[model samples]
Target: QGVVDPLGGINTLWPLFGIGNQMLASMALILGTVVLFKMKKQRYAWVTILPTVWLFITSMTAGWQKIFHEKPSIGFLAQANKFRKGLDEGVIIAPAKSVADMQTIVFSNQINAALCAFFMLVAVTMLISAFFVIRRALRSDLPTTHESVVTLRNKEVRHV
Candidate 1:
């Protein structure tokens, strides 16, 4: 689900590839927004951050649900667990539920792990970049500094 399908259609291309890259996509958007804030104005930053916030919230919520999801047919981990349980019980499980299926499960898990790591690294880079931007902004605003004045507060930036 795209969260708001009316705005745009949901993308199924990733599911076919066994990758859910929504979080990565959203984090990229957020990283771009952060960059825009630094290159543009702090006031504009506040406004631009709204969509990023929504994206972040939805991405995180969806990721959490997918990892701990209850549905066997939906979540990958759940599906794998169910298949394993079925195999252990010697019951017919998931279509072929055999060594091949186990291999696939392990492969899918590794892919998921790589995706998570990639996303985490990106998020950390964005956070660090944003931190530096914020620190620079704060440094320039010290009372002793004689730099061209720029207000940090949104209310004040509105007037600027």
Candidate 2:
């Protein structure tokens, strides 16, 4: 029987994917809250607002940890730096059997770090925009974009 490493493959990619997914979810919730406010249903906005706040906090914290944590297995930038230093010193690491492998690992980790940073930036931007929209909605300064209700009278109703 062969030993199976549960996180042997795709471990690095999974965290990035998860962070992106959560960020998108957070944005959707924020948008939902803004729409509720725009419709002048401020009391019902908490349904989306609460989840938005929670997801934002969780996702941002995860992203930050992935980018800045000291552990190579946990942080993309840290892993990249570790491999880079190994390459600079002409040392071949266990996970990296060759110099080319080390270079590739370093590049991949850097790309992952950049992607995490970009996701965080987009999430922050969306949150800021939603904040302003909700504020304007509360002040009645923003017009509702939802279509107005049109009542159909008996005379206006026609059989298809």
Looking at model 1, which ten-residue stretch has the lowest summed lDDT? Answer: 4-13
What is the clash tally of candidate 1?
Answer: 0
lDDT, candidates in the order shown: 0.52, 0.82
lDDT, candidate 2, 1-63, per-residue tens: 001212234766778889999999999998888888887878988899888889999999999
Which portions of model 2 show Cα errors greater than 4 Å? Answer: 1-9, 141-143, 147-160
Candidate 1: give the clashing pairs: none
Worst window of 10 by summed lDDT in candidate 2:
1-10
Instruction: Look at candidate 2 and tell me the lDDT of residue 116.
Output: 94
- TM-score computed on alpha carbons, candidate 1: 0.60
TM-score of each prediction: 0.60, 0.84
State the lDDT at 150 in candidate 1: 57
Candidate 1 local lDDT, residue 77: 64
lDDT of 1 by residue, 42-94 (tens): 56666557776776666656655445567854554666577567656766544
Candidate whose lDDT is highest: 2
